[model samples]
Target: MFPIVSKLPDVGTSIFSVMTQLAQECGAINLAQGFPDYDPPLALQEALARHATTPGHHQYAPMPGLPRLREAIAHKTARVYQVPAPDPATEITVTCGATEALYAALAAVVHPGDEVVVLEPAYDLYGPAIRLQGGIPVYVPLDSPTFRINWERVRAALTPRTRLLMINSPHNPSGAVLTTEDLESLAALVADTPILILSDEVYEHMVFDGVPHRSALQHPALRERTFVLSSFGKTYHATGWKVGYCIAPPALTAELRRVHQFLTFAVSTPTQHALADALETDPAHDQQLPAFYQPKRDLFRELLAASRFELLPVLGGYFQLARYSQISTTESDVAFAQRLTRESGVAVVPVSAFYHNGHDEGLIRFCFAKQEATLRAAADRLREL
Candidate 1:
């Protein structure tokens, strides 16, 4: 029997897992994790059921993904980004999920002592992935109240040892989407730098209020030096399907697949077939995503308006942020989240959990990706405060 040391000693269960478990334990309306309570599109579900019985789909897909799925992704990319379609065979690799793609991307790029710059209140996975590869993570806090990036601070954070910059738009917890100006500024900043980008666009199809998602793939220079990742689960409201894809330059794709080949080898076969059919059979599902989620975001905002929680502007994505400074000035974000779950019977993630230092901003994030009944039920519990 050998004594084992933990690689991620500071890491335990994720906040999403922790809060969701607590919500279940307390019999609360679970809004802590960003997942829909609704089913995926009927077309996709039917495709899955049909494909599952098909002979070839029961086994492994291509290491790069099912070719049909890759081709469909390529077509979608060309249409949305208005850029040259990446050769599906050489540049696109289907992943287990966006999480695995992101992990594989970091493993492909980062080496010992390298630094990866991250914008905070970032997704929790970024820092740990960097650290797992023996790399340093430099945190740059997005400006409070608005969670928008400051370019000067970003510029200051980058140095010669900086190997990667991670960007998440339609950001988790805050729902901040990157603007065109932000992209142009990013392109200018990285123009001469050797740094590569891991652009997390899982929420790509979910931008709201007529604002474009400004994908890294849309900028020629940025596209050349980036690994762009997105999720079918997000597009079709089937998150448990865990199907995602990565598009990079041929060389970068080669490097990522080297890591990804060992990481998961391939995503689910039938699910890939289902997503391919979903993409090709009805492009409107992705096209109408913003419209689909905007009303729910609005509904949540409207219903929660009377509560002591201050609603933050939701530019995109399914999550909403509520400031609790008005509700309770004493408790840390973690304590408030726990207490809120226990007393109010609604669970929300603490925004501070996304920060490395646990930098409390007196904010909690609620997942509005729920049923109308669930949203109303959660609001009913919350407004009683």
Candidate 2:
């Protein structure tokens, strides 16, 4: 019999999977996972079908990515951030999704026993991926009220063993966007350290209430050390397509590609071609994302106003966190989510699942990335609770 590695034994089934299964079994409205229950742009879909029939796009794309797609990403970054365009041939490598890009980046840079600093409540992938590469994940909790980083806590967590910092904004589950001042604070802390950064900006276009989305590439000092990861799947409402890219300085990109080539080698050819077309010809698709998502968020919030749950402040992303302390004395978030799914026919993810220490916060995360009627249906069901 083979022995199993014990680094990730504590991590078993994900909250998303368990809640989704319960939702299916109970015939409940699923608002647990972060994927949209809507289709992507029609034009992009048509382009993919058209490209599939074309003879030229049927073959494998280059190891880095299709040249045109890389160029389109470069143009988009330059236009939005006022940054220099990276060489498509050298600085961009497409991966299966932002998930794979994150894994590849960590694998390429982290040595065994190296400490990778993470911001929590973090996406579940970051900790496991770091551990799989034999690196330690050091978590610094974001303070409540604002859910912003506590700079003193962050500085205290840093040591000579720190090799990388993983950050996400506008953050998932919390809906907190990092401000320019926050970026400045990060830059100052790592200015003299040998640490690199992996910035997950998958929800880049979903900022609300006139708050601008800050890009890691926009900060001059952090640019060289940062590997900015983004997903076309999230931006285009096509999560199943699973196309994402990473941008970094050539020196850092070189290492990213070394790991990327072995881990999927290339993304889907037709999707890459179609995404290139979408990026070049349809800027309006991403430009209109906030308006597209804000109404659903507002409607969900409006519907929840009559319920016992108190809505937390939402700044970005398709998720909204709500405290359920008033509804029940049950302090366990996992138990609350399961009960809500079974009795109320509405499913949500426990917020405590995102934290490393697993502190029960009496909170749950509900995703609003669904159609108007879907959001309305989930809200209507929650009103009875």
Candidate 3:
């Protein structure tokens, strides 16, 4: 057998995969991964079905994306963010998902020996993707109490070798939304550095508490250098569709498309058409998501109030982080998660897994993207602990 690539040899099964498997075996309520059990809007589903039978949609879409979808995205961007509409031809490229778009953007920009700064605990994909491109990932930790970035630490991490910075807003596992001040700070830090910014805004529609989602595109200086990536899956509850788009300046978009064309060429044609329809006509669906999910969040919090776990503040996304220090003496987050799954019949992802050094502590992440009954059942079971 051929020897494996040494760069990624240390990477085994993902924590999500392993925890989900354990969750299945234990018949636990799986809150390990961030995917909804509920179906997407019936209108989107109907559109998909209609497109499947409608003539010409079955063929491969244009390399960038279907023109209608790109135009719809442009309109949506202008309507929601007040940004000028992107030229569908030169400034937009659709990929298999935001994952693919992220990968492509990284590959296109990062060179050998380049330093890419990523905030920790980051999404698992960022480090591996950087490593694969021969770029080093410099992780800056965001510990608790504030979960905000230390600007001084971020400045210290930058060097002449620094090429890009990957940031996620409405962040995963933490439910932290980047504030306007945070974006201004980021802009100040990267102003003279020639560093590219990849802003993952997949959960853009999920902000709560009247907080407006701050997009990199909304910042004038950041917009010039930023590649903004968003997923239709997260917005529309259609994770399996795997249709996502990226917007960038023409130059950056060109480079990303070079990698994207070879990666997936294009996403499924019919789904693109269906998403176009959703973006154009059913925009209200996503506009209401924050209100829709807030009740679930409140319900889950209410249910878990009596439990030993202390729920952290959730600002956005489907995730809620909780500290279990009172329930168990176990210091290891992974062990605590495993024990919870086996004994409490509720599966959660250990927050420590998001850190580079495997931070074993009392924190775990729960996905609240379940049906009300599911959330209630899981919360009830968790109360027994």
Q: What is the C-alpha lDDT of each candidate?
A: 0.91, 0.92, 0.91
lDDT of 2 at 81: 74
Residue 269 lDDT (model 3): 93
Q: In terms of lDDT, which candidate is stronger, 2 or 3?
A: 2
Off-target runs (Cα >4 Å) in candidate 3 are: none
Measured against the true structure, the TM-scores of the candidates, in listed sequence, are 0.99, 0.98, 0.98
Candidate 1, superposed: residue stretches over 4 Å from native? none
lDDT of 2 by residue, 212-274 (tens): 899999998998899999999999999999999999889999999999989999899999999
Task: Write one digit per residue (lDDT tens) for candidate 3, span 1-385.
Answer: 9966587887889999999999999999999988999999999999999999999988999999999999999988888899898889999998999999999999999998999998988889999999999999999987574577888899999999999988898898788899889899999999987999999999999988898899998999999999999999999988988889999999999999999999999889999988998888877777899999888899899999999998999888889999998988755899889999999899999988898788665789999989999999998999988
Structure candidate 2, residue pairs in collision? none
Clashes of 3: 0
Measured with C-alpha atoms, the lDDT of residue 265 in candidate 2 is: 91
